[model samples]
Target: MTVKLTNIRIITCHGEEVIEKGEVLFNEKGILDVGQRVNTDEHEIQEIDGSGLTVLPGLIDSHVHLGMDSSPDPFANMKNEGPEDIAFKAVQQGYRFLQSGITSVRNLGTRYNVDISYRNAVSVGTVVGPRVFAAGSPIVMTGGHGHVMAIEADGCDEVRKAARSQIKAGADLLKVMATGGVLTEGNDPGATQFSEEELRCICQEANKASKTTAAHTIGTDGIKNAIRAGVTTIEHAYLLDEEAVELMLKKGTFLVPTLLAPRLILDKPGAVPEYMIDKVRKIIADHKISFQLAHQAGVPIAAGTDAGTPFNTPGLLSDELALMVEYGMTNHEAIYSATLGAAKAIQKETEIGSIENGKAADLIVVSGNPLENIRCLDSLVYVFSKGAIVHHAPVNKQEKQEQIV
Candidate 1:
């Protein structure tokens, strides 16, 4: 069915521009037309009055672990649950992402190929969720960070095999653990795990299959090593030095700054493990500083919350974008980070990044302009995924009166 949204403000993330009083026409397949004026047949057309609404491409979360629930001590919780149980809970969480106006998500790491299955389920119309790009499972050093849900590999040859295994399992990308992490026992967040040689082998394997690699890196040394090894995007990156920033800029590597992950751990200290809290407290300041340095240095930054970690709930793209603004980015830049910037990080820019002709109709209609106040995203009125209305909320009379007055 054809649908047209008329008389709306369009935040086309194509650049720093907005189309006022524009129209967008789309069907289940893709976007047909979009501009200040769209020519469409009146016959059998479903028109939605978009007055007082701002329409933009839905958010893309570049880093997430769907199999891990965002509970205190999620690793312990996962030990108790089976794969079937995890998949069921992940499906519900997927819906939560759609409700938050996230249309595309990249599952950087998950156990049991749960994300790959979810991706297939969404593709075949068996479930309703955001477009999924699954890594199947991350390749980690033996007893490295997130090894519970990752493939443990050692040396260059082992990492190469692990990368191929994920790709063979239908992974869209390869997730490699470049350093230790906060949640894992006996792991120091700044300690490098994968050597540069091992990282290069993983990246080469992914490149052979035309897939990108996202490296979970925190320490400055590991960050630079990953960049030198051709890793596509660096996640966390809590400890970036000038050299690391320059390397990323020179290499054209993207940064998936998951500021929300550590912040949330600090916010609810008692709710999470004490060890996790300690780790975050040590790195919180450095994390923010790294993000600011990278942003100021013109390193490509993509918005990712690192959801499914301790207290970092899924479907919180807006919160991450808002934090990006607080750090140093302009509102336009933050929104782009989550939309087109993130799409580029995951290599989906041509498919679902912005409001353009022939692109997937993954959009959201919010009550206020996000470019002005990103918190306005909280008032989402409609969420469209692939031209299908997945979520809708009626505009009450009081809200409409305030808009008019």
Candidate 2:
């Protein structure tokens, strides 16, 4: 199917200039052309009138867990649920994300490869959802954070073997638990879980398999170790010290702060554990400072909400953008973090990050200008993924009449 979206304002991160009145042409396979205007009447394409809307590349969420729920004991819930049940829930989450104008998502962790199965299903047209880069299961040390749902391995040799196993299982990326987490009980959030040598070995194995590694590190030491070991992205560097931040900037590592994950806990105190609530309350106070430091130090920051965590919804990633703006990021920078920066973090920049001529036809049309008010992202009227419209907000009859007249 061919589609022509005309009379739209296009925002591309490649240049400072914006196309005030532009058109995008796409077929079923991918985007065919994008310019200020294109000859479309001869092509027998379905023309979509975009009179007053702004069109941008589809949003990407760099960190997500597709098959997990935010229960009081999320790991215990995962253990009890069968794979079939998990797969169904994952598909549901994927669809929800698509509806919210997110064309692609990187699943940071999942139970038993359920996210991988869901990704395959979406690729094969068996399901209707956003594009997914799945990490089958995160590698963690024995009794470490996320160990309940992760593959537990000890030492460098075991870590290397475990990482290779994930690659063989069709993981797009390898996730490693490099430090203790807030959600997991009986673990210190400030402690490191994987040794520096073990992290290096895991990265080496992942590189051999041509897979990227994302380290889930929160504490200062773990953050430094993950950066030194060459992990592509740091999931949550909540307790990053000056040394760690400097190393990250020097190494050009991408940081997906996942600010919403901790902020959610603080905002809705009743949703998470009391201990986590208190921990997050303290962390939230300092998170903005850390983010500002990372920004000032030239560290690449991407927006990731850590969706599927307690109080974090799949379709509401715009909240993360709002938080980014709160942390000294301009509206345009925050939007770019969710789009281009996120794609770069996940290594999918060539395919779906921008509204380019040869990229996938993954775009969103919002009713208002997002540049003026970032929250206008929530006013999505149309969303397209791979040239397919997955979500279309119904236009009010009165508004339709006004447009017609």
Candidate 3:
């Protein structure tokens, strides 16, 4: 069956001017047409009146961990959690993402290929959630960052083998720990992890399999190493130096700034472990500066909240966007970063991320114009995934009877 939405304002997020009073027609496969009245002869069309609402492409979160439980003891949940238990929990996390208008997500790393299985389940419709591109596990050194979910390998040959293992297990991308992370017990967030040669080997293997590599680096030399080694995206690059920024610009590497991750931890002292509070507070100020510098340097910025962490719950992309604007980006630039910029970061620009004909009908409807005030996104009235109305609320009784099909 075909679906038609009429009387809606469209923000393509493609650098195109907004289209007021537009129409959108789509099928189960993809969007058939957008803008003006969709000319269709199909009699079994589901027409929805979208008056007083603004529609745009669904959001994309470029960096996320689907299996981690958002709690004070995040790592504890991973200790004894089996595959089935983690997968079931991930299903819930995914629905929360969709309800918040996030239609596509990238799972950066998870234990035991759980992220890969979760992504497949979403793809086959066995689970109801966003379209997921998953990186099965992180390639780390022995006792390295994210050791729990990491494929620990010390040599370049071992790193290449690790990358290939993830590819064979159906990973859409490869995640490497280029630097130590805050969450890992006793790891210095300012220290580099793998050697440059090892990073290059991993990147080379992932590129051969046509998979993008996201390097988790929070230190200066580590960030530079990832960029020089041809990593596709950098995550948590708060310690970015002049050399790293120049290298990122030269290589055209994108940044998935998980800015709100540490802020969430630092804000609620009791919700996180004591060590985290100290660690996050130390670099929170510099984190803001790094993002500002990246924005000023014209680096491609993708908004990715490291959800499933303590205090950084799912469905907080709005917070991330607001923070982006606060840091330096305009409302339009912030929205674009989450939409098309995120799509390109994951190398899926041709399929989704905009209101275009022949693309996936992943979209959200809000009560007010998000262009003028992005806070309007907090008022989502309707959400569509692949032309199916996955979430909806009727305004009144009489209209509800007519509008809800």
Candidate 4:
């Protein structure tokens, strides 16, 4: 199938310029051309009129959990469900994300290696979903944060073996619980869960398997340890200090702030426990300073909402972009973080990040300019993934009546 999109405003994220009247051409394999104009034989192509729409590369979410339920105690809920149930929920979430204009997502953690199976299903056209890069069951310490659904191991040797096991199970990436978390009861969010030696062992094992590592770190000490050990990305650096920020910049570590998690737990009081709410509030207050410091120090940042959490849905990733703007990023910068910056973190820069020639035709068209009002992303007119239209809003009744008359 060949598609010709013309007369649209395009933001390529290739440079600092926006093309007001641009054209894009795509075939069954990938994008063929993207520029100001390209002549095509009308008889052999399907034309899509984009007279007053803005087109952008499909957004990518770097941090997400597909198997999570919509309850506050999702971990407990997962424990009761079987692998088949989990797979069904994961496919549903994946389609929801696609409808929201997100063409790809990284699954940070899952139980029974369900993400790998689901990824294969999508690749073979048996399922309708986004491109998935999954991390099979995360590595955690016994009784540590995320232990409910993670593979719990202690000591350097045990951690290394666990990492190898995950790799053998077809994990695209390795996830380690480097620090405590808020959602799990009896775990202090300010404590480090893994020693430096253990972290280094996990990283080394993952490296041997030719896979990247993402550390779930929040405290300052844990953040420093993960950065020094050469992990690829840091998730939720809530208590980041000046030294940690500097080390991150020096080591060229990318940060996935997951700004929505803190805000969701704080702003919506009833979604979480009272004790959890207080902790989240305190963390949010402290996060403002560290987040601003990271921004001022030139640390690389990516937009990840940690979706599937309570009050954080898959289709609401645009809220993360708004939070970035509130934290001193321009609208274009926020959008770029969600697109090109995220692709860079996942090591997929050449494939699906931007509206460039010879790339996958994963794109979204909106009725208004998101560059001016970022909220316009919510009103998607059409969504195309891999040269196929996945979502299209129906024309209104008034317009249909006028056309009939």
Please tell me which predicted candidate would have the highest lDDT against the true structure: 1
Best by TM-score: 1
**Whole-model lDDT values for every prediction:** 0.89, 0.84, 0.86, 0.85
Q: State the lDDT of candidate 3 residue by residue for 1-405, as single tens digits.
A: 798889989888878668899998887788899986779989999987877778899999888888888787576678688888888888999999999999999998888889888888788989899999999878899999888877899998788889898899999999999998878878888899998999999999988998899999988889988999999999999888777788888899999989889988877878777877877777888888889888899889888998878867778998899899888788888889888899999989999888898899999888767777778778778889988888886555454333332
Q: How well is each residue in 24-81 modelled by candidate 4, as lDDT tens digits?
A: 9987688888889977675678887776678899999989888887566677788887
Query: Per-residue alpha-carbon lDDT of model 2 for 249-338, expressed as tens digits?
Result: 788899998888886677766666787776666566566777788877878887888887786879778998988888778888888998
Where does model 2 exceed 4 Å of error? Answer: 40-42, 396-405
Worst 10 residues of 1 by lDDT: 396-405
Clashes of each: 0, 0, 0, 0
State candidate 2's TM-score: 0.95
Against the true structure, what is each candidate's TM-score? 0.98, 0.95, 0.96, 0.95
From the highest lDDT down, the ranking of the candidates is 1, 3, 4, 2
Task: Tell me the TM-score of model 3.
Answer: 0.96
Q: In candidate 2, list every pair of residues with a backbone clash.
A: none
Cα displacement (angstroms), candidate 3, residue 254, comes to 0.5
Q: What is the lDDT of residue 275 in candidate 4?
A: 66
